[model samples]
Target chain A: MSELTPLNAIGEFALINRLQAGLTLRQPGSVLGIGDDAAIIRPTAGTELVMTTDLLVEGIHFDLSFCPLRHLGYKAVAVNVSDVAAMNALPTQLVVALSVGPRFTVEAVEELYAGLRLACEAYNVDLVGGDTTASRGGLTLAITVLGEAPTGKAVRRSGGKPTDLLCVSGDLGGAFLGLQVLEREKQAFMADPETQPELANYEYVVQRQLRPEARLDIVHELRELGVHPTSMIDVSDGLASEVLHLCAASGTGARVFSEFLPLANPTLEAAAEFNLDPITCALNGGEDYELLFTVPVTDHEKIKNHPDITILGHLTGKEEGTNLITKAGQPVPLKAQGWTSF
Target chain B: MSELTPLNAIGEFALINRLQAGLTLRQPGSVLGIGDDAAIIRPTAGTELVMTTDLLVEGIHFDLSFCPLRHLGYKAVAVNVSDVAAMNALPTQLVVALSVGPRFTVEAVEELYAGLRLACEAYNVDLVGGDTTASRGGLTLAITVLGEAPTGKAVRRSGGKPTDLLCVSGDLGGAFLGLQVLEREKQAFMADPETQPELANYEYVVQRQLRPEARLDIVHELRELGVHPTSMIDVSDGLASEVLHLCAASGTGARVFSEFLPLANPTLEAAAEFNLDPITCALNGGEDYELLFTVPVTDHEKIKNHPDITILGHLTGKEEGTNLITKAGQPVPLKAQGWTSF
Candidate 1:
């Protein structure tokens, strides 16, 4: 390890100076950035603003023993951005508030900011302003993202109508399986200090868990194809829970076909190794950061052949109830069973 | 104590349901509120958005021993709203994210939100969206405020000129003294649990510490009087510190007259009771949430005799340095002993 300065050594002002030195504003609406009582932005004319905030607690949301600081920072920003994309909006700015304990060094904070900057660069978003303070417990990250969409264009989870085709972006269960592998390796390392855990073969699943990407590309593609989703949500708390959210908000029921659920090969292999069912993981696993939406059946032609898109099922009347049709031709009531910290 | 529901008993979804039921939409721009992936708002045309975020950590920022949960919630929102007021903006919406430990009851969370809702209603700001989850340690609150100001009309800390008149609204040092009283009472209570704390004598100061109001009324008064501040900041970290911030940002210096400083009777009495200098408390104490600003010398006549406004001194060249002019005709360089979490 390199010699690094602890946060207290340089004090809060110096730390803020070091962090602000590398920021470059890329958003035209960002009239004024940091170094003020507040940030100033000019929302684009004729557009509406979309805002979302998410809090990630240390022990509850992640374990530092397995989660890298940089990846944790990236994931924090990505999850909030995912929420914006779920509204069919383009992310523009982010305000990140972080609290760290005494154990966190300035270099560790820099590594975390590096990941934040990387995400900003990838998503074309600007870091506007935030508050940084010392924590009494473990590290906590609270990120708020600002996005924009044309008036009347932003989607909502309550807009879905019966018979609308349900679709999902990317694959699921990879992140959950990835977490299982990391937990297993951590337990092994804890039990025997001399053991060197081999993880080369589990790279794909592990990376999914460490660094999930937001599906903003799908939002752009839908706009380009002139196909607007009637309703949308991000798959953060598992597909089953998110589907239930959509159903509850839209006052409709959903029929998700188990056969059409997307599952990557690495996820399946990892689930098997853990003696867990792959389908269950795909259905109930969380933190995939995928976009789930419903579009009119007539618009399916525009999205059907897309490589990253999968048609899960369609919306149904509220009387039908939300269910998952298994491959064995049995209907099971969809239970959320989302990851709950309480 | 009354019977209360544990957080786990009702679960996350049920808690959300209970909280959302009480929220009503007051902001016309709020196209979509909670129950969606993100909140949507349309800022009035040709207005710039002012954004600010603050994080308050348990044990670090406040002590639950004396700090009521409702007051903590109100203070969290007020502090951020104070930032918006410093920018000469009207607050419109807020996003509050909270993390609570398992020990917190559903009733406790509702008490916190009741305070939040009260603040929102008082400021006419909508509670648009947020995320709530479990924490490993104590309660944490992260609040982000969104406000609007006409383009090019928002005040900034860097707009002061050499001849600008330095001014502050309301009195100072009350909150700091209030905190001192609370700490002393808490120590006494800890020494003997049977002792009933007497707070009637310290009502004014105690209230200041528990519920500091954002000076939005001052922002409105300034606008109505046709006096646009050249530079502004909220007194969150002492008068001397905030003066230095304005000076550093504006590339100027300031001369504050100690005799002209505003000190409430309660603040002076409290400081004397602790055997601390009243002047020092007025200068170095924080969390007053008062507006400290500068205006052109030509506009002094318009604000000179305002009941709540005090003309502290005037800005000076950087070479002159920031100083506090004492009643004995002595000039002392101002020091920024602002609160530091680290």
Candidate 2:
């Protein structure tokens, strides 16, 4: 949307061109790219396609007050990539359906596309085709990411063994705490029109909210480590909630020590400053965008020495039930208080 | 939306569960459906897949004043299927990501799903996966449909020939006029709330808006008749605009007789009632969801007697340019003023 003069960034047809431009296909199977009634991609051989979709609403999933448009676009593609990643596959293409209110300028739309293009480059994805429409209300983005994995190789949440080690990549709760800090700062600004957000002390937490990266790098790293998780799900809804999904799908229980939870220094500091329980935030606050997977014990040694991976717990017998063990060895039931938009 | 009392629908989780429960996936490739991060489709034969996405925003693409939740859901699926149909492929699966506000309820979401499931059933498509989230504003729907065609056989809009006979299936502008009448009635109702809608006269046009069907049946029939369109595009954006696309993509021009443009009885009546030109509506107004294609003239004889197919004109050399020749033999320059939400 960068321009020298006053402009309406999202003049219906221009958005379609922006999305289709700069995307080059590597395969002949891409029968079509853009500017048509429908996009056509030849199905791959020896593999059935994996598909997933996500909708990100403006005021609900993000706020322009703190969340930059570029990062939001990146996160938008990243989360969809995470789904493809969670399927233990490599994403090859994407279709974006964008709806925006007239308030958005072409420059704003370009900024969003800049972030989206960045993700497409890093992930080696082609922006094939999509519909761009006007919204009567907010800016809404709906992305459908297409991925491919060898037939029968997609890791499902139901395949974990009772003895599998529960592991996570990167940290948890940063995005949640980041949201908290952003909300607090916005409130401060609203109370005093002249006041600016004072966020030097909470930079990391703020970054976590404004810009979140999916753990696709971990996906590649794990591929190099020669490990395929028996049961995998991303930390999208919150740790406890995702754990419940893995447990329910695998028909097992989880036992983890509270001390083993990973929390960044900034996250812990910000949580305490806000009078929040860091442990609870890590447990129930969502948007961590990390990888939560269960691997057979045999595969543990491969990742155990890795710096970013965290071995939080082990899959448990059903009779033991889904529980959280304290630092002092006490047991408590685990519950899923995931972020509910409705 | 059907519920007399909406207060009980506040908790969104229950509604999600209810919608998820009644639906079933019968696809052989579907390893899982609807309950996880993503659905896995074990593609057979590692074939080339066709993927397309369409976005529909409330107020822009639809009006709640006339479009029911059920028909909105049906139309959403239908339009996506129309894209797949344009490819001359068989639809196998779909993923729908939906955003709605609190005004919607458990039963309301179910009504929408019921309509979607009906389209899926009729079209032999499986509902593989989707994202359901809350919207801060009006409802938004993004549906991505996956289709399958034999390797090297998918049709595209860029393959038209200069001498190809331009053909169309069914009629046009019913949906457009349908929208016009709906908007008119909505205004009338705003002027006097005591009046019931005078909609019976516009029933067919209204149905075109409410329950537009994809031309998948025509796709099958074309195959049975041993016809492969030299070029094809769906008539979602109206006859003239689609003709322009077919010509532009093929580096050719099209000359169509406005006399040959098909119109449903209700569309003509509504146009007359509104003091509007039916031919203009058929030319520029969109959302028809019919098949518009160009077949080699050699193959036209084969389809000359086919009930649903109507030969309109022929593709011409680019030098001749795109034109709409009226019954009196006057050449009119064609401009594609398809519906623009912006």
Q: Of the candidates shown, which would achieve the greatest lDDT relative to the real structure?
A: 1
Candidate 2, B1-342: lDDT as tens digits:
343425244554565676777678877877777776777777656455678899988888888778888888888999999998898887888999899876876666778898898888888899988888888777899999888777666788989989899999998888888888888888999999987998888889989888999999999999888998877889888788888888988999888988988877888998998888999998888998898898899996789998788888899999999999999999897888887777
Q: Which ten residues in a row have the lowest lDDT in candidate 1 chain B?
A: B193-202
User: Per-prediction TM-score, please?
Assistant: 0.99, 0.95
Q: Please state the interface RMSD for every predicted structure, separated by commas.
A: 0.6, 2.1
Docking class of 2: medium
Candidate 2: segments with Cα more than 4 A from true spot: A1-10, A26-29, A193-196, B1-12
The 10-residue segment with the lowest total lDDT in model 1 chain A: A193-202
Tens digit of per-residue lDDT, candidate 1, span B26-139: 988888888788999999887899999999999999999999999998999999999999999999988988999988999999999998998998888998998899998899
DockQ of 2: 0.67
Candidate 2 colliding pairs = A1-A106, A1-A107, A9-A105, A9-A106, A42-B48, A43-B48, A43-B49
Residue pairs in clash, model 1: none
Global lDDT of each candidate? 0.92, 0.83
